[model samples]
Target: MGRLRHPGRYRDERRPERACRGRADRLLALLSGLAPYVDARFSLLCHSYGSVVCAHAAPLLAQTGVQVSDIVNLASPGLDVSTVGELGTSARVWVAQAASDRIGWVPNVRVFGVGHGRDPLDPAFGARAVDVDDAQGHDGYLVAGTSSVRRLTAIAVGTGDAHSVLAAR
Candidate 1:
């Protein structure tokens, strides 16, 4: 539900797995609707549960010919998948979790299909990791004046990688 050019927020405190699935469907539709207006592939920047929506929609987007160049997840508990291969997309996947963020303690497990899967930052999850040790907290990834924002911007624009991008500047 996120486009790199624009960012938005969603609130769903009473979250449930069933509701998330519905949101993923809607997100898929919205992206599909906007695909025609884009001159290039989509780069999704998602945080928290929004990462779950992106993860669910990514493979569907691929099947429907929506070219997604990158997906960057911030403070994500899980993407509902144990590994990148389970995501079923060719887009480069990135995950950033601040060291002080408490979400790291959340177990990436599915109890009767009601939980997010493996922690996205887990080494076995296979996403390009973004170092956000300087971020203030879980919600600070996109906050202006943070180092993570700079690295994230570079990745989204496809001009750089996580480590070398800012150094080249």
Candidate 2:
């Protein structure tokens, strides 16, 4: 999996919403370069700001014939895209947000281009929600022994149903 980083440190608290268009373009280029070498369809697991980049790159990736099997968003701040269907791909969309995650308090709405947009975990956002009850906060989803990690692992490896794993939690 490729990890993306913004060019500059987004430290300005006043402008919490850093422009992600450039980052998205970089991600597109990275994925395009990887497409030829990758043999099987892959899943995208994005966390926080990375989800914003995924949202922006989804359509572009489809246009390039990238085979995306699934997209898992963990503690996403927000997504600029209006609908999951607008992602322009056949990938199954999954989302998880811990109750204790501070990012959950971020407004789901976009204003002055500040916020990304709607919460992917919202029922109306059309994504399958995974249980993260055992997660502590924004960064806890991947912690070892957590139910979130187990479900996420299942989703990543395509061995078990993520919803079923969550149900057992």
Predicted model with the maximum TM-score = 2
Task: Give per-residue CA lDDT, model 2, range 1-169, as digits (tens).
Answer: 5566532355554554344666778777877887787767767888888888778777777755567778888889777876799777688888888889999888888878677788887677888888778999778989999777888888887754744654322
lDDT value for candidate 2? 0.76
TM-score of each: 0.83, 0.84
Residue 45 error for model 1, in Å?
A: 0.7
* Local accuracy by lDDT, each model: 0.75, 0.76
Off by over 4 Å in 1: 1-15, 63-65, 165-169
Estimate, for each residue in 1-169, the C-alpha lDDT of model 1 and write its tens digit: 3432111233443455545667778878887777678757778888777788778787887755567889988878788888999988899998888878888888888887567878877778888887666787767887788777878888888875645432211
The per-prediction tally of clashing pairs is 0, 0
User: Largest lDDT belongs to which candidate?
Assistant: 2
Q: How far does residue 71 in candidate 2 sit from its true spot (Å)?
A: 0.7
Error of 1 at 104 (Å): 1.5
Off by over 4 Å in 2: 5-18, 162-169
